[model samples]
Target: MSTQEERSGRYLDFYRDNIERISENSSPYINSFRQNAIEEFKKLGIPTRKNESYRYTNLDTFFGHPYSSYFMPSEPDFVKAEEFRCDVTDLDAHGVVLINGFYPTITGKLRELPGGIWIGSLSEASRKFSGMIEQHYGRYVNGNSDGLVHLNTALASDGVFLWIPEGVSLGKPIQIVNLVNSDQDIFNQHRNLIIAEKNSDITLIICDHTLSPQKFLTNAVTEIHVGENAHFNIIRVQNEHNNAAKITHTFIHQERNSVATSNNITLHGGLVRNSTHHYLGGVGAECNSFGLYLSDKFQHVDNYVNVDHAFPSCKSNQLFKGVLDDMATGAFNGRIYVHPDAQGTMAYQKNSSILLTDDAKMDTKPQLEIYADDVKCSHGATVGQLDENALFYLRSRGIDKRQARLMLMFGFAHEVLQNINVEALRERMDNLVMQRLKGELSRCASCMVKCV
Candidate 1:
């Protein structure tokens, strides 16, 4: 019943012994960065079934696996562009690709971006713009995170760094391809930071591409700093192979009058956990988020979303929906906090899911902590199935039982998908969903829609 830290995990002891050795004071780029993180990781250790946030998912074997550094990647694993293929991409978009958590060679040239925007590798940013990294890195995250986040900071070796100067907007979206293809059991902590100054706009695509059979762990952290009048759209697509385990933390920091839109989509992952936290630090800022998760077979997904309205006149709207079949398990926890100073704030949150199989399980919690009396906020959660009445009506109309079920199920997901603004993304998601409705998505379901 308790979610507090347990005294029995050895990872914490590992951290107590290793934190000082891996302290950043030695130099952010110390060669031992990964080892330092490993020390902290041992201290913080992986979360157990006891941690309130991790109560639904257990990592007994995940942490028990041996750790190996991917710092010096050898020859390319020949799973080149054609084999671990990505769907077609629009050439005009700003594309940034990562292979196995490291930046990869660009086969195609990129068009010149807006004049004031600079997109480069984190190494370049750390060497030239230490000021920015110092001011913003881990600024919004809880510094006391047992050791998961600290390990991420310590072990991070590759990521994207984006900066937008004042008054400039990049209309096209920037795609970040995060690939995982290690030959052995590996743990990679990747970090990315994006800063949008006054009056600029940008969109980011975070894709998880996998092609490895080894047990892998990805603790990815992305920090976004949204300044005055800036607008940002962050889209995350998870399609990792079944053998991968990925945990992500995306932090959004907003200033006055800025807007942040975060879209989380999960189609496949062996064991995926996404933690998205937003801090509305500026007055008049607005935030909107939509998430879609589909889990089948033995896959497991856990999402934790937190929003902190620290200033007045801010607004946020969030909705997360999931579809689970077979023996898959899913969890959703959303928290919105209205601080004492955040008066006149308006916020709404909703979490919903549908389990098609009797063995499928979904647990959702929608929470609100309001310290301000002058705020309007509401939250709701639901777990149910396709409407039997709707199915019956369709069946009465001579529609086949399978077609009727597929239509109703697609209708359920449409509530969340309709909010997407990107036409291509919407179309792609539609196809994936239809694959499910048509019963061509996977083989684990018994009563599935047949796709042509």
Candidate 2:
């Protein structure tokens, strides 16, 4: 067998051997879908460049490493959860922690706050809210053919589950911190479900971090449902070490008159791929997607976005920017699809990147597929170095070369950063971006978990 097939076979054998353990703590409703998902995974296997969606990223390199999968919940350490401090200060938000893809038994399995908000483990929520889980758990990912999605569905045990009741507006944002801390190479898969009921509003902040130097591979899937006239905002911050590979798939469905926004900031990683799918299924639905990535050394980052306009009067906008230094590489793929019956659809996409070194590389593809005649759509991409004219203008004004370059890079990245609605988060991200541009390591200074 070829090397790719050998690597893929490992996972197939793994699922066969651990199927019972994987389903041990899961509910019947969740376990019922595992068999079919694994069958689909067998047909798809691990994705390679042959797959158009995964053309820019080659998963074989990351999957070749031998890593132990986390099938059951690890020993809970509430002390670590309580002692951990978020890099973002003055941001008063509810905190939830997940260690190696399992929610720690911190404060019961589920925590229900005022205003009828539920935040806690997905496995626990599966037992308590079976009706809700059955309705939305696999709904968004039902028709997906991606191997990673199927693999996650087959093996994922627990993750974050959030529910905002109808007509309720959360006073504070929900912050979720996912940490991978282990002595040996580890493979993790976590699934998250978020429901925003009719007329409800909420903001979510997701942070991904690695606390150990061991090789870590994480595959995370999140499904979000926005009810009629509701609003949901999510900001994702990823900061891991060079020995980590992180893959995230997020599926969002918006209902009538609903508004949703997603902002992703990628700081450091060995390999990172973020795939986001947005479905505007109701009239007057709107979504805005933005991302910023900074990478140096041998790191790689990829962002993929697909927006579907299935109803009339829907709108979407995608803007992504990246800064690559040394031998780093990046990719951005943005696609907008408008159905034939969806009239009055407005969609736009743009991707821009700056390469600091001759060896740094970037690949961008912006696509638009519209079947409606009256719809408006546009797409564009740019890959180039910082404008010499701008840099020269700054240097002539008595600014040093290094500082001038940092200023120009930050200015380019600020376009995507400005869209962050949370003032505290925006400021913290701004500082982090500057630090990244100044050649500093992307470690969270205030985080209690130390890396090797």
**Global lDDT scores for all candidate models:** 0.74, 0.89
Number of clashes in every candidate structure? 5, 0
- Ten-residue region with minimum lDDT total, candidate 2: 443-452
Superposition error at 36 for model 2 (Å): 0.6
**CA shift of 137, model 1, Å:** 2.2
Q: Candidate 2 residues 1-452, lDDT tens each? A: 24766877888888899989878889999999999998998889888888888888877667887897655545544556656778787788998988888888856889998798999999999999999999899999879989999999998989999999999998889999998877779899999999999999999999998877888999999999999999999999999988899999999999999999999999888899999999999999999999999998889999999999999999999999999999999999898999999999999999999999999999898778889988988888899988999999999999998999999999999999999888898898898899888877556555444553
Candidate 1, residues 194-285, lDDT tens digits: the string is: 88888988888887866555778788888889989998888888877566788988889899999999988887777888888888989999
Clashing pairs in 2: none
After superposition, candidate 2 runs with Cα above 4 Å error: 76-78, 446-452
TM agreement with the true structure for every prediction: 0.87, 0.97
TM for candidate 2 is: 0.97
Error of 1 at 20 (Å): 14
